[model samples]
Target: MDQRSELSEFLRSRRARLKPEDVGLRDHGRHRRVPGLRREELAQLAGVSVAYYTRLEQGNAQNVSVEVLDAIGRALRLNDIEQDHLTHLAKGKAKKKRAAACRPQQVRPALQQLMDSMDHVPAHLIGRRLDILGWNRMAAALLGDMSQLPPQERNLARHVFLDPASRSLYVDWHGKAIDVVSILRLCAGCYPNDPQLTALVGELSVKSEEFRTMWAAHTVAEKGHGVRRLRHPVVGELTLAYETLKLPDEHDLSLVTFHAEPGSASEESLRLLGSWSADQPVRTG
Candidate 1:
Protein backbone atom coordinates (compact mmCIF):
# COMPACT_ATOMS: atom_id res chain seq x y z
CA MET A 1 0.00 0.00 0.00
CA ASP A 2 1.21 3.52 -0.82
CA GLN A 3 1.80 5.37 2.45
CA ARG A 4 0.78 8.72 1.01
CA SER A 5 -2.47 7.34 -0.36
CA GLU A 6 -3.24 5.59 2.93
CA LEU A 7 -2.65 8.78 4.86
CA SER A 8 -4.75 10.84 2.48
CA GLU A 9 -7.70 8.46 2.49
CA PHE A 10 -7.56 8.10 6.29
CA LEU A 11 -7.70 11.85 6.79
CA ARG A 12 -10.49 12.31 4.24
CA SER A 13 -12.57 9.51 5.75
CA ARG A 14 -12.17 10.96 9.23
CA ARG A 15 -13.08 14.43 8.02
CA ALA A 16 -16.16 13.14 6.20
CA ARG A 17 -17.50 11.48 9.35
CA LEU A 18 -17.83 14.71 11.31
CA LYS A 19 -20.37 17.52 10.80
CA PRO A 20 -20.08 21.30 11.30
CA GLU A 21 -22.34 21.16 14.35
CA ASP A 22 -20.16 18.40 15.84
CA VAL A 23 -17.29 20.82 16.49
CA GLY A 24 -19.44 23.69 17.77
CA LEU A 25 -19.53 25.37 14.33
CA ARG A 26 -22.93 26.97 13.68
CA ASP A 27 -24.83 25.92 10.59
CA HIS A 28 -26.02 29.23 9.15
CA GLY A 29 -28.63 27.33 7.09
CA ARG A 30 -26.25 27.52 4.15
CA HIS A 31 -26.34 24.83 1.45
CA ARG A 32 -23.23 22.70 1.82
CA ARG A 33 -21.62 21.09 -1.22
CA VAL A 34 -19.14 18.98 0.77
CA PRO A 35 -19.62 16.58 3.65
CA GLY A 36 -18.45 17.22 7.21
CA LEU A 37 -16.33 20.28 8.11
CA ARG A 38 -14.82 22.22 5.24
CA ARG A 39 -11.07 22.47 4.82
CA GLU A 40 -11.08 26.12 5.96
CA GLU A 41 -13.22 25.32 9.01
CA LEU A 42 -10.86 22.51 10.07
CA ALA A 43 -7.86 24.75 9.46
CA GLN A 44 -9.41 27.46 11.63
CA LEU A 45 -10.12 24.97 14.41
CA ALA A 46 -6.60 23.52 14.18
CA GLY A 47 -5.06 27.03 14.25
CA VAL A 48 -3.23 26.48 10.95
CA SER A 49 -3.43 28.15 7.56
CA VAL A 50 -5.86 26.63 5.08
CA ALA A 51 -3.03 26.13 2.58
CA TYR A 52 -0.96 24.19 5.14
CA TYR A 53 -3.85 21.97 6.13
CA THR A 54 -4.68 21.33 2.49
CA ARG A 55 -1.09 20.38 1.76
CA LEU A 56 -1.05 17.99 4.71
CA GLU A 57 -4.30 16.37 3.61
CA GLN A 58 -2.92 16.12 0.07
CA GLY A 59 0.08 14.17 1.43
CA ASN A 60 2.53 16.87 0.26
CA ALA A 61 3.59 18.10 3.72
CA GLN A 62 7.06 16.99 4.83
CA ASN A 63 8.27 16.43 8.39
CA VAL A 64 4.91 17.19 9.98
CA SER A 65 5.52 18.01 13.63
CA VAL A 66 3.80 16.10 16.45
CA GLU A 67 2.21 19.32 17.64
CA VAL A 68 0.54 19.93 14.26
CA LEU A 69 -0.68 16.33 14.07
CA ASP A 70 -2.05 16.55 17.59
CA ALA A 71 -3.78 19.83 16.73
CA ILE A 72 -5.37 18.26 13.67
CA GLY A 73 -6.39 15.21 15.71
CA ARG A 74 -8.14 17.49 18.19
CA ALA A 75 -9.86 19.37 15.40
CA LEU A 76 -11.11 16.11 13.94
CA ARG A 77 -12.30 14.80 17.34
CA LEU A 78 -10.01 11.76 17.17
CA ASN A 79 -9.74 9.45 20.14
CA ASP A 80 -6.45 8.21 21.62
CA ILE A 81 -6.06 5.35 19.11
CA GLU A 82 -7.07 7.54 16.15
CA GLN A 83 -4.72 10.32 17.30
CA ASP A 84 -1.85 7.82 17.51
CA HIS A 85 -2.66 6.58 14.00
CA LEU A 86 -2.63 10.19 12.74
CA THR A 87 0.80 10.66 14.30
CA HIS A 88 2.08 7.42 12.77
CA LEU A 89 0.89 8.37 9.28
CA ALA A 90 2.08 11.98 9.39
CA LYS A 91 5.50 11.02 10.81
CA GLY A 92 6.23 9.19 7.53
CA LYS A 93 8.78 6.43 6.94
CA ALA A 94 12.05 8.37 7.21
CA LYS A 95 12.56 7.42 10.86
CA LYS A 96 11.02 3.94 10.69
CA LYS A 97 12.64 0.70 9.57
CA ARG A 98 10.53 -1.82 7.65
CA ALA A 99 10.29 -5.53 8.40
CA ALA A 100 10.50 -7.73 5.30
CA ALA A 101 8.18 -10.47 6.49
CA CYS A 102 5.62 -11.04 9.24
CA ARG A 103 7.17 -14.25 10.52
CA PRO A 104 6.56 -15.84 13.90
CA GLN A 105 9.49 -15.81 16.30
CA GLN A 106 10.90 -19.07 17.64
CA VAL A 107 9.15 -20.08 20.82
CA ARG A 108 11.60 -20.44 23.68
CA PRO A 109 11.40 -23.77 25.52
CA ALA A 110 11.01 -22.00 28.88
CA LEU A 111 8.13 -19.96 27.58
CA GLN A 112 6.46 -23.05 26.23
CA GLN A 113 6.94 -24.76 29.59
CA LEU A 114 5.41 -21.84 31.42
CA MET A 115 2.34 -21.91 29.19
CA ASP A 116 2.06 -25.69 29.59
CA SER A 117 2.14 -25.25 33.37
CA MET A 118 -1.01 -23.12 33.26
CA ASP A 119 -3.21 -26.20 33.36
CA HIS A 120 -6.56 -24.50 33.73
CA VAL A 121 -6.02 -21.21 31.91
CA PRO A 122 -6.19 -21.11 28.13
CA ALA A 123 -2.92 -19.53 27.08
CA HIS A 124 -1.35 -18.84 23.70
CA LEU A 125 1.53 -16.86 22.24
CA ILE A 126 0.96 -14.58 19.25
CA GLY A 127 3.60 -12.82 17.20
CA ARG A 128 3.38 -10.10 14.54
CA ARG A 129 0.16 -10.12 12.48
CA LEU A 130 -1.51 -12.03 15.33
CA ASP A 131 -0.05 -15.31 14.20
CA ILE A 132 -0.57 -18.15 16.62
CA LEU A 133 3.09 -18.92 17.21
CA GLY A 134 2.45 -21.38 20.02
CA TRP A 135 -0.53 -22.50 22.03
CA ASN A 136 -1.12 -24.74 25.05
CA ARG A 137 -3.50 -27.68 25.06
CA MET A 138 -6.10 -25.77 27.06
CA ALA A 139 -6.03 -22.95 24.54
CA ALA A 140 -6.68 -25.45 21.77
CA ALA A 141 -9.54 -26.88 23.79
CA LEU A 142 -11.04 -23.46 24.50
CA LEU A 143 -10.50 -22.02 21.06
CA GLY A 144 -10.11 -24.29 18.03
CA ASP A 145 -7.23 -26.70 17.70
CA MET A 146 -4.63 -24.44 16.14
CA SER A 147 -2.28 -27.42 15.75
CA GLN A 148 -4.54 -28.78 13.00
CA LEU A 149 -4.24 -25.66 10.88
CA PRO A 150 -1.47 -25.02 8.36
CA PRO A 151 1.13 -22.50 9.52
CA GLN A 152 0.00 -19.92 6.96
CA GLU A 153 -3.60 -20.19 8.13
CA ARG A 154 -2.75 -19.75 11.85
CA ASN A 155 -3.44 -16.01 11.92
CA LEU A 156 -6.25 -14.79 14.18
CA ALA A 157 -7.41 -12.22 11.64
CA ARG A 158 -7.62 -14.78 8.86
CA HIS A 159 -9.50 -17.23 11.08
CA VAL A 160 -11.96 -14.53 12.10
CA PHE A 161 -12.53 -13.39 8.54
CA LEU A 162 -12.25 -16.59 6.49
CA ASP A 163 -13.00 -19.53 8.77
CA PRO A 164 -16.54 -20.75 9.29
CA ALA A 165 -15.86 -22.05 12.84
CA SER A 166 -14.94 -18.60 14.14
CA ARG A 167 -18.51 -17.41 13.79
CA SER A 168 -19.63 -20.09 16.23
CA LEU A 169 -16.62 -19.68 18.54
CA TYR A 170 -17.10 -15.97 19.21
CA VAL A 171 -20.42 -14.96 20.77
CA ASP A 172 -19.99 -11.37 19.59
CA TRP A 173 -18.71 -12.31 16.16
CA HIS A 174 -19.30 -8.91 14.52
CA GLY A 175 -17.58 -7.01 17.33
CA LYS A 176 -14.66 -9.42 17.28
CA ALA A 177 -14.34 -9.06 13.51
CA ILE A 178 -14.20 -5.25 13.80
CA ASP A 179 -11.60 -5.46 16.58
CA VAL A 180 -9.48 -7.85 14.50
CA VAL A 181 -9.56 -5.49 11.51
CA SER A 182 -8.74 -2.46 13.66
CA ILE A 183 -5.79 -4.27 15.22
CA LEU A 184 -4.62 -5.29 11.75
CA ARG A 185 -4.80 -1.65 10.67
CA LEU A 186 -2.62 -0.69 13.61
CA CYS A 187 -0.12 -3.39 12.59
CA ALA A 188 -0.17 -2.14 8.99
CA GLY A 189 1.03 1.28 10.14
CA CYS A 190 3.81 -0.33 12.17
CA TYR A 191 4.92 -2.81 9.52
CA PRO A 192 4.03 -1.33 6.16
CA ASN A 193 6.52 -3.41 4.14
CA ASP A 194 5.86 -6.88 5.51
CA PRO A 195 5.14 -9.06 2.49
CA GLN A 196 3.12 -11.60 4.43
CA LEU A 197 1.00 -8.89 5.99
CA THR A 198 0.38 -7.30 2.61
CA ALA A 199 -0.66 -10.66 1.17
CA LEU A 200 -2.93 -11.38 4.13
CA VAL A 201 -4.64 -8.02 3.83
CA GLY A 202 -5.10 -8.37 0.09
CA GLU A 203 -6.52 -11.87 0.46
CA LEU A 204 -8.99 -10.85 3.15
CA SER A 205 -10.04 -7.74 1.24
CA VAL A 206 -10.79 -9.81 -1.82
CA LYS A 207 -12.51 -12.66 0.01
CA SER A 208 -14.57 -10.86 2.66
CA GLU A 209 -16.68 -7.79 2.06
CA GLU A 210 -16.83 -7.14 5.83
CA PHE A 211 -13.07 -7.13 6.02
CA ARG A 212 -12.80 -4.79 3.07
CA THR A 213 -15.25 -2.28 4.53
CA MET A 214 -13.62 -2.33 7.97
CA TRP A 215 -10.16 -2.05 6.45
CA ALA A 216 -11.22 1.01 4.46
CA ALA A 217 -12.42 2.72 7.63
CA HIS A 218 -8.76 2.93 8.80
CA THR A 219 -9.58 2.26 12.44
CA VAL A 220 -6.62 1.38 14.66
CA ALA A 221 -6.44 -0.31 18.05
CA GLU A 222 -4.03 -2.11 20.35
CA LYS A 223 -4.84 -5.43 22.03
CA GLY A 224 -5.52 -5.05 25.73
CA HIS A 225 -7.07 -6.86 28.66
CA GLY A 226 -10.80 -7.38 28.19
CA VAL A 227 -13.74 -9.67 28.81
CA ARG A 228 -14.59 -12.09 26.01
CA ARG A 229 -17.72 -14.08 25.39
CA LEU A 230 -16.93 -17.34 23.67
CA ARG A 231 -19.06 -20.30 22.65
CA HIS A 232 -16.89 -23.38 22.66
CA PRO A 233 -18.17 -26.20 20.48
CA VAL A 234 -18.03 -28.69 23.34
CA VAL A 235 -18.29 -26.47 26.42
CA GLY A 236 -21.01 -24.15 25.16
CA GLU A 237 -21.09 -20.44 26.11
CA LEU A 238 -18.41 -19.03 28.39
CA THR A 239 -17.62 -15.60 29.75
CA LEU A 240 -13.92 -15.18 30.36
CA ALA A 241 -11.65 -12.28 31.22
CA TYR A 242 -8.48 -12.20 29.17
CA GLU A 243 -5.16 -10.51 29.85
CA THR A 244 -2.55 -9.68 27.22
CA LEU A 245 1.03 -9.73 28.50
CA LYS A 246 3.93 -8.57 26.39
CA LEU A 247 6.84 -10.97 26.56
CA PRO A 248 10.06 -9.61 28.00
CA ASP A 249 12.88 -8.99 25.50
CA GLU A 250 10.47 -9.73 22.66
CA HIS A 251 9.25 -6.82 20.60
CA ASP A 252 6.49 -8.64 18.72
CA LEU A 253 5.54 -11.58 20.98
CA SER A 254 2.65 -11.46 23.44
CA LEU A 255 1.11 -14.08 25.73
CA VAL A 256 -2.66 -14.02 26.02
CA THR A 257 -4.41 -15.97 28.80
CA PHE A 258 -8.05 -16.36 29.63
CA HIS A 259 -9.59 -16.82 33.06
CA ALA A 260 -13.15 -17.36 34.12
CA GLU A 261 -14.75 -15.46 37.01
CA PRO A 262 -14.71 -17.40 40.26
CA GLY A 263 -17.99 -19.06 41.33
CA SER A 264 -19.39 -18.66 37.85
CA ALA A 265 -20.68 -21.38 35.56
CA SER A 266 -17.88 -20.45 33.14
CA GLU A 267 -15.36 -21.44 35.77
CA GLU A 268 -16.88 -24.92 36.01
CA SER A 269 -16.92 -25.19 32.25
CA LEU A 270 -13.22 -24.26 32.07
CA ARG A 271 -12.33 -26.96 34.58
CA LEU A 272 -14.30 -29.49 32.59
CA LEU A 273 -12.59 -28.36 29.41
CA GLY A 274 -9.19 -28.72 31.06
CA SER A 275 -9.93 -32.28 32.10
CA TRP A 276 -11.22 -33.09 28.64
CA SER A 277 -8.07 -31.66 27.07
CA ALA A 278 -5.90 -33.76 29.41
CA ASP A 279 -7.81 -36.91 28.60
CA GLN A 280 -7.33 -36.42 24.86
CA PRO A 281 -4.52 -38.41 23.23
CA VAL A 282 -1.35 -36.38 22.89
CA ARG A 283 0.24 -36.35 19.48
CA THR A 284 3.59 -38.05 19.37
CA GLY A 285 6.14 -36.19 17.31
Candidate 2:
Protein backbone atom coordinates (compact mmCIF):
# COMPACT_ATOMS: atom_id res chain seq x y z
CA MET A 1 0.00 0.00 0.00
CA ASP A 2 1.12 3.55 -0.72
CA GLN A 3 1.63 5.21 2.65
CA ARG A 4 0.79 8.68 1.39
CA SER A 5 -2.47 7.65 -0.22
CA GLU A 6 -3.45 5.52 2.75
CA LEU A 7 -2.71 8.37 5.14
CA SER A 8 -4.67 10.87 3.04
CA GLU A 9 -7.71 8.64 2.69
CA PHE A 10 -7.70 7.70 6.39
CA LEU A 11 -7.66 11.36 7.43
CA ARG A 12 -10.35 12.34 4.93
CA SER A 13 -12.60 9.45 5.96
CA ARG A 14 -12.24 10.33 9.67
CA ARG A 15 -12.92 14.00 8.97
CA ALA A 16 -16.02 13.19 6.92
CA ARG A 17 -17.47 11.21 9.82
CA LEU A 18 -17.46 14.20 12.20
CA LYS A 19 -20.13 16.93 12.23
CA PRO A 20 -19.59 20.67 12.82
CA GLU A 21 -22.09 20.65 15.64
CA ASP A 22 -20.36 17.70 17.25
CA VAL A 23 -17.36 19.88 18.16
CA GLY A 24 -19.26 23.00 19.29
CA LEU A 25 -19.38 24.75 15.90
CA ARG A 26 -22.41 26.99 15.33
CA ASP A 27 -24.64 25.62 12.56
CA HIS A 28 -25.15 27.95 9.57
CA GLY A 29 -28.26 26.02 8.51
CA ARG A 30 -27.23 26.10 4.81
CA HIS A 31 -26.46 23.18 2.53
CA ARG A 32 -22.80 22.22 2.81
CA ARG A 33 -20.52 20.72 0.19
CA VAL A 34 -19.08 18.17 2.59
CA PRO A 35 -20.63 16.03 5.33
CA GLY A 36 -18.31 17.20 8.13
CA LEU A 37 -16.58 20.41 9.16
CA ARG A 38 -14.82 22.28 6.40
CA ARG A 39 -11.01 22.50 6.31
CA GLU A 40 -10.86 26.01 7.79
CA GLU A 41 -13.34 25.12 10.54
CA LEU A 42 -11.28 22.08 11.61
CA ALA A 43 -8.08 24.12 11.47
CA GLN A 44 -9.62 26.76 13.73
CA LEU A 45 -10.67 24.10 16.23
CA ALA A 46 -7.21 22.49 16.22
CA GLY A 47 -5.54 25.91 16.66
CA VAL A 48 -3.50 25.49 13.49
CA SER A 49 -3.27 27.45 10.25
CA VAL A 50 -5.63 26.21 7.54
CA ALA A 51 -2.77 25.81 5.06
CA TYR A 52 -0.73 23.67 7.50
CA TYR A 53 -3.72 21.51 8.36
CA THR A 54 -4.55 21.09 4.69
CA ARG A 55 -0.97 19.98 3.98
CA LEU A 56 -1.20 17.44 6.78
CA GLU A 57 -4.52 16.14 5.46
CA GLN A 58 -2.96 15.88 2.01
CA GLY A 59 -0.44 13.39 3.51
CA ASN A 60 2.48 15.82 3.86
CA ALA A 61 2.55 15.19 7.59
CA GLN A 62 6.33 14.78 7.98
CA ASN A 63 7.79 16.30 11.17
CA VAL A 64 4.38 17.00 12.73
CA SER A 65 4.82 17.66 16.46
CA VAL A 66 3.12 15.53 19.10
CA GLU A 67 1.22 18.56 20.43
CA VAL A 68 -0.10 19.41 16.97
CA LEU A 69 -1.10 15.80 16.26
CA ASP A 70 -2.90 15.53 19.60
CA ALA A 71 -4.75 18.76 18.88
CA ILE A 72 -5.83 17.46 15.51
CA GLY A 73 -6.87 14.12 16.99
CA ARG A 74 -8.97 15.86 19.64
CA ALA A 75 -10.54 18.18 17.06
CA LEU A 76 -11.41 15.18 14.91
CA ARG A 77 -13.03 13.39 17.90
CA LEU A 78 -10.88 10.30 17.40
CA ASN A 79 -11.25 7.34 19.71
CA ASP A 80 -8.22 5.56 21.21
CA ILE A 81 -7.74 3.34 18.16
CA GLU A 82 -8.15 6.26 15.74
CA GLN A 83 -5.80 8.40 17.81
CA ASP A 84 -3.11 5.69 17.68
CA HIS A 85 -3.58 5.39 13.92
CA LEU A 86 -3.16 9.14 13.55
CA THR A 87 0.16 8.94 15.39
CA HIS A 88 1.31 6.08 13.15
CA LEU A 89 0.42 8.08 10.05
CA ALA A 90 2.17 11.22 11.27
CA LYS A 91 5.37 9.21 11.89
CA GLY A 92 5.23 7.65 8.39
CA LYS A 93 6.01 4.29 10.05
CA ALA A 94 4.02 2.37 7.48
CA LYS A 95 7.02 2.55 5.12
CA LYS A 96 9.16 0.37 7.37
CA LYS A 97 10.57 -2.91 5.99
CA ARG A 98 8.78 -6.17 6.59
CA ALA A 99 9.42 -7.76 9.99
CA ALA A 100 11.76 -10.76 9.92
CA ALA A 101 9.75 -13.93 9.96
CA CYS A 102 10.00 -15.50 13.42
CA ARG A 103 8.71 -18.73 14.85
CA PRO A 104 5.11 -18.63 16.04
CA GLN A 105 4.90 -17.39 19.63
CA GLN A 106 4.20 -19.95 22.30
CA VAL A 107 2.23 -19.33 25.47
CA ARG A 108 4.69 -18.76 28.33
CA PRO A 109 4.90 -21.35 31.06
CA ALA A 110 3.58 -18.89 33.65
CA LEU A 111 0.65 -18.05 31.42
CA GLN A 112 -0.18 -21.72 31.07
CA GLN A 113 0.03 -22.11 34.83
CA LEU A 114 -2.33 -19.16 35.29
CA MET A 115 -4.83 -20.57 32.82
CA ASP A 116 -4.70 -23.96 34.48
CA SER A 117 -5.30 -22.43 37.90
CA MET A 118 -8.43 -20.63 36.70
CA ASP A 119 -10.61 -23.73 36.67
CA HIS A 120 -13.92 -21.89 36.34
CA VAL A 121 -12.88 -19.07 33.99
CA PRO A 122 -12.37 -19.69 30.31
CA ALA A 123 -9.06 -18.29 29.10
CA HIS A 124 -6.97 -18.43 25.92
CA LEU A 125 -4.09 -16.76 24.11
CA ILE A 126 -4.27 -15.58 20.49
CA GLY A 127 -1.75 -14.28 17.95
CA ARG A 128 -2.12 -11.36 15.54
CA ARG A 129 -3.96 -13.57 13.03
CA LEU A 130 -6.31 -14.71 15.82
CA ASP A 131 -4.75 -18.17 16.05
CA ILE A 132 -5.47 -19.88 19.32
CA LEU A 133 -1.95 -20.43 20.61
CA GLY A 134 -3.19 -22.02 23.79
CA TRP A 135 -6.34 -22.27 25.88
CA ASN A 136 -7.60 -23.69 29.12
CA ARG A 137 -9.88 -26.69 29.13
CA MET A 138 -12.90 -24.50 29.89
CA ALA A 139 -12.26 -22.34 26.82
CA ALA A 140 -11.68 -25.43 24.68
CA ALA A 141 -15.09 -26.84 25.64
CA LEU A 142 -16.86 -23.53 25.01
CA LEU A 143 -15.50 -23.57 21.45
CA GLY A 144 -16.14 -27.10 20.27
CA ASP A 145 -13.93 -28.88 17.72
CA MET A 146 -11.71 -25.79 17.26
CA SER A 147 -8.61 -27.82 18.10
CA GLN A 148 -9.34 -30.20 15.25
CA LEU A 149 -8.88 -27.49 12.60
CA PRO A 150 -5.70 -27.48 10.52
CA PRO A 151 -2.96 -25.28 11.94
CA GLN A 152 -3.35 -22.65 9.24
CA GLU A 153 -7.16 -22.64 9.52
CA ARG A 154 -7.31 -22.41 13.34
CA ASN A 155 -7.42 -18.61 13.23
CA LEU A 156 -10.56 -17.27 14.89
CA ALA A 157 -11.14 -14.52 12.32
CA ARG A 158 -10.81 -16.85 9.31
CA HIS A 159 -12.88 -19.58 10.96
CA VAL A 160 -15.61 -17.18 11.95
CA PHE A 161 -16.05 -15.99 8.37
CA LEU A 162 -15.11 -19.11 6.45
CA ASP A 163 -16.32 -22.00 8.63
CA PRO A 164 -20.06 -22.61 8.89
CA ALA A 165 -19.69 -24.21 12.31
CA SER A 166 -18.26 -21.02 13.81
CA ARG A 167 -21.24 -18.97 12.62
CA SER A 168 -23.67 -21.52 13.99
CA LEU A 169 -21.85 -21.66 17.35
CA TYR A 170 -21.96 -17.94 18.04
CA VAL A 171 -25.32 -16.61 19.11
CA ASP A 172 -24.61 -13.04 17.94
CA TRP A 173 -22.56 -13.92 14.88
CA HIS A 174 -23.02 -10.55 13.13
CA GLY A 175 -21.67 -8.56 16.07
CA LYS A 176 -18.58 -10.74 16.33
CA ALA A 177 -18.03 -10.47 12.59
CA ILE A 178 -17.93 -6.68 12.78
CA ASP A 179 -15.52 -6.79 15.70
CA VAL A 180 -13.26 -9.18 13.82
CA VAL A 181 -13.10 -6.89 10.78
CA SER A 182 -12.43 -3.84 12.92
CA ILE A 183 -9.57 -5.59 14.67
CA LEU A 184 -8.14 -6.69 11.32
CA ARG A 185 -8.27 -3.11 10.07
CA LEU A 186 -6.22 -2.06 13.04
CA CYS A 187 -3.74 -4.84 12.28
CA ALA A 188 -3.54 -3.81 8.61
CA GLY A 189 -2.40 -0.32 9.52
CA CYS A 190 0.36 -1.72 11.70
CA TYR A 191 1.56 -4.26 9.15
CA PRO A 192 0.57 -2.96 5.73
CA ASN A 193 3.29 -4.92 3.95
CA ASP A 194 2.84 -8.25 5.71
CA PRO A 195 2.37 -10.84 2.93
CA GLN A 196 0.47 -13.22 5.17
CA LEU A 197 -1.86 -10.48 6.29
CA THR A 198 -2.33 -9.30 2.72
CA ALA A 199 -3.10 -12.86 1.65
CA LEU A 200 -5.63 -13.19 4.46
CA VAL A 201 -7.30 -10.00 3.27
CA GLY A 202 -7.46 -11.25 -0.33
CA GLU A 203 -8.92 -14.60 0.70
CA LEU A 204 -11.60 -13.03 2.90
CA SER A 205 -12.44 -10.40 0.28
CA VAL A 206 -13.10 -13.17 -2.25
CA LYS A 207 -14.82 -15.59 0.12
CA SER A 208 -17.20 -13.36 2.04
CA GLU A 209 -19.10 -10.28 0.82
CA GLU A 210 -19.65 -9.12 4.39
CA PHE A 211 -15.89 -9.18 5.08
CA ARG A 212 -15.21 -7.20 1.93
CA THR A 213 -17.71 -4.48 2.85
CA MET A 214 -16.48 -4.11 6.41
CA TRP A 215 -12.82 -4.05 5.34
CA ALA A 216 -13.60 -1.16 2.99
CA ALA A 217 -14.87 0.92 5.93
CA HIS A 218 -11.26 1.21 7.32
CA THR A 219 -12.45 0.65 10.87
CA VAL A 220 -9.89 0.07 13.70
CA ALA A 221 -10.23 -1.23 17.22
CA GLU A 222 -8.36 -1.87 20.51
CA LYS A 223 -8.84 -4.95 22.63
CA GLY A 224 -10.40 -4.08 25.97
CA HIS A 225 -13.17 -5.06 28.32
CA GLY A 226 -16.18 -6.48 26.53
CA VAL A 227 -19.09 -8.93 26.68
CA ARG A 228 -19.48 -12.04 24.56
CA ARG A 229 -22.53 -14.22 24.02
CA LEU A 230 -21.99 -17.80 22.91
CA ARG A 231 -24.26 -20.72 22.05
CA HIS A 232 -22.26 -23.77 23.13
CA PRO A 233 -23.45 -27.03 21.64
CA VAL A 234 -23.14 -28.80 24.97
CA VAL A 235 -23.98 -26.01 27.42
CA GLY A 236 -26.52 -23.89 25.55
CA GLU A 237 -26.40 -20.04 25.91
CA LEU A 238 -23.65 -18.25 27.81
CA THR A 239 -22.95 -14.55 28.41
CA LEU A 240 -19.44 -13.72 29.54
CA ALA A 241 -17.43 -10.61 30.32
CA TYR A 242 -13.90 -10.69 28.90
CA GLU A 243 -10.62 -8.76 29.22
CA THR A 244 -7.63 -8.87 26.83
CA LEU A 245 -4.07 -8.29 28.00
CA LYS A 246 -1.19 -7.93 25.60
CA LEU A 247 1.94 -9.96 26.29
CA PRO A 248 5.30 -8.22 26.39
CA ASP A 249 8.22 -9.55 24.24
CA GLU A 250 5.74 -11.05 21.79
CA HIS A 251 4.43 -9.15 18.82
CA ASP A 252 0.61 -8.99 18.89
CA LEU A 253 -0.07 -11.83 21.34
CA SER A 254 -2.93 -11.34 23.78
CA LEU A 255 -4.30 -13.33 26.68
CA VAL A 256 -8.06 -13.22 26.98
CA THR A 257 -10.12 -14.34 29.97
CA PHE A 258 -13.87 -14.77 30.12
CA HIS A 259 -15.93 -14.36 33.28
CA ALA A 260 -19.62 -14.60 33.95
CA GLU A 261 -21.25 -11.83 35.93
CA PRO A 262 -21.87 -12.86 39.53
CA GLY A 263 -25.14 -14.65 40.49
CA SER A 264 -26.31 -14.75 36.89
CA ALA A 265 -27.57 -17.79 35.06
CA SER A 266 -24.56 -17.43 32.81
CA GLU A 267 -22.34 -18.09 35.80
CA GLU A 268 -24.24 -21.31 36.49
CA SER A 269 -23.87 -22.32 32.86
CA LEU A 270 -20.10 -21.64 32.96
CA ARG A 271 -19.72 -23.84 36.04
CA LEU A 272 -21.55 -26.61 34.27
CA LEU A 273 -19.40 -26.17 31.16
CA GLY A 274 -16.20 -26.20 33.16
CA SER A 275 -17.22 -29.43 34.82
CA TRP A 276 -17.99 -30.99 31.47
CA SER A 277 -14.68 -29.84 29.97
CA ALA A 278 -12.84 -31.38 32.92
CA ASP A 279 -14.46 -34.72 32.23
CA GLN A 280 -13.39 -34.69 28.53
CA PRO A 281 -9.91 -35.78 27.45
CA VAL A 282 -7.36 -33.04 26.77
CA ARG A 283 -6.81 -32.01 23.17
CA THR A 284 -3.42 -31.84 21.45
CA GLY A 285 -2.76 -28.71 19.40
lDDT of each: 0.85, 0.81
Query: Best candidate per lDDT, number?
Result: 1
Model 2 lDDT tens row, 201-261: 8899999999988877777886677888898888788889999988777758898899999
- For residue 126, give model 2's deviation from the true position in Å: 1.2
Q: Which pairs clash in the backbone of model 2?
A: none
Give TM-scores for every candidate, taking all chains together and pairing residue i with residue i.
Answer: 0.94, 0.86
Put down candidate 1 lDDT per residue, 1-285, tens digits, no spaces: 667777888888889888988999997998988888888989999999999999999976587888999899999999998887777777865236474343446789889889888889999988888888888888888887777777878889998999999999999999999888988888787777777888999999999999999998888888888999999988889999999999779867889999999999999999999888898754210
lDDT of 2 at 108: 78
Stretches > 4 Å off in candidate 2: 94-97, 100-103, 279-284
Decoy 2 TM-score against native? 0.86
Q: Tell me the lDDT of model 1 at 154.
A: 86
RMSD of each: 2.0, 2.6
